[model samples]
Target: MAKKKVSKTIDDINRKIKEGKVVVVTADEMVGIVKKNGAEKAAQEVDVVTTGTFSPMCSSGAFINFGHTKPGIKASRTWLNDVPAYAGLAAVDCYMGATEPREDDPLNGVHPGQFKYGGGHVLHDLIAGKKVELRATSYGTDCYPETQVKKKITLSDLPYAMMLNPRNAYQNYNCAINLTKKTIYTYMGILKPNGGNANYATAGELSPLFNDPYYRTIGLGTRIFLGGAKGHVIAPGTQHNPNAERHENGIPLTPSGTLMVSGDMKEMDPRWVVGVSMLGYGCSLAVGLGIPIPILDAEMAEYTGVSD
Candidate 1:
């Protein structure tokens, strides 16, 4: 069978956005709407659909530049609340990785570091208006005379704090199943033994890529709701698989188009961005994101109408 062709355009979507007539629906809400009103009527009435998900993504972190201290110090080593922050980029600039294990993790010997307080937790603390310890050391350069510095700082003290996540939302992913008799720990959360339970990722119909499965509306510059703040899709995320198998509606049935998203960490709320521990796996961040899919035409509405 021939592949289905999508026919929505940007200009048409923009017009709806301008007119304030866009219809937005969440994934959990789409199935009922489609069944009640039918795809045709639902599509014609809806101009935009809002999809959202809160999932743990490990490949996420933030880069922050704490303005130089008096006399300046080329920060060579740094730690935040005892969790190491990468300080090799430049003086006073550090990248706090989301999954960097806690140095003094109580569970170090028993399992992978509990990751109870990693970069993501630091970010959450910073966003919640809490103070954190900032420690750094330098080799004492002539240009930057200061060698060592230790101070308590808040997120407000930094001039720039940006979350540059390598990967965020996935277009679609598989449901994890464990074939072994024992429970398995994985990035997709815990899996039970031998069909005891199936863990599925994605927000079902309420996911951004699921709504625009073929990358029709989602691309560079598309505005998205990231980690409790407004963000944008900068590029295709790492391991983007656009050629995956698809359903009749063109939504890929396998892991597909992912997004490289970024936003100002300063504007984020602690509620939507959180640090999580996967028992035996490791630490990660559960990020919440929402995207508005514009229903540009009948075809676009039909796409939005898909459920389950």
Candidate 2:
């Protein structure tokens, strides 16, 4: 069989952004958005904030910061106004082969893959304070591959790859996973756990829990853990379990013991929710959110940035 192409184009990048699939943005770009216009003005310009993607097992999201000054209530309101009522379903990361291969040998060159591609926008106008939270509901389908083994594996255990949509590469976010039910969770918040100047010798640093398979499943009233902290866990009552039977046709369903991994949203900066309302009012209506997005690179880059 012939090898599949691994590179993407500018158009592909734009398409993902318009769809609200891209959400991470750079600190400079985010700061520019805020500086160009107050938070509300920047918020209105956004389309879809791309959270990170998970293939069969992994994920990431865009990040942001507010500096020392807090965004005003009006700016915060504008930020809220730009967001969709219900953020789409959470997307699961899957492994895509660098090249197309026979069905019998699909995993040949596959690596950690991201759910979608595109850029993201950040809201710097919001207040910067401890325990401040940004709330937004996510909507996307989960693709679970049937398991061949009986033992459970953390998403970090699987071999995976990434595909980048160059336009929106600066986005960042903290990530979590629900193993039992096989779901990925993302949140917009401060980046202390994922960021900071803690060295290996330090003891009091916040340690993030990534790829821990013992976490709970996704269900109504299920406690969703974010970045390894109990305080970050989303209470069971906040989100509901997805119906297993009504999954999209193309998504593969893995059996029990499947390894489900999630990426941690970085804390160095503030994250953005690319608002898709500028182009249209309907959720189904697609709009390009022009921001560079990142994917899990085969070879890790010094920092996630746009490809020239």
Q: Who wins the lDDT comparison?
A: 1
Error of 1 at 295 (Å): 0.5
TM-score of 2: 0.18
Instruction: Supply every candidate's count of residue pairs whose N, Cα or C atoms clash at under 3 angstroms.
Output: 3, 81
Off by over 4 Å in 1: 1-22, 36-40, 106-108
lDDT of each: 0.81, 0.23
Whole-model lDDT, model 2? 0.23
Give one digit per residue, the lDDT tens place, for model 2 in 175-220.
4323342222222211234333222210010111111111222212
C-alpha TM-score for every candidate: 0.90, 0.18
The residue-level lDDT of candidate 2 at 145 comes to 26
Q: Which segments of candidate 2 are over 4 A away from where they belong?
A: 1-124, 127-231, 237-239, 246-268, 271-278, 282-308
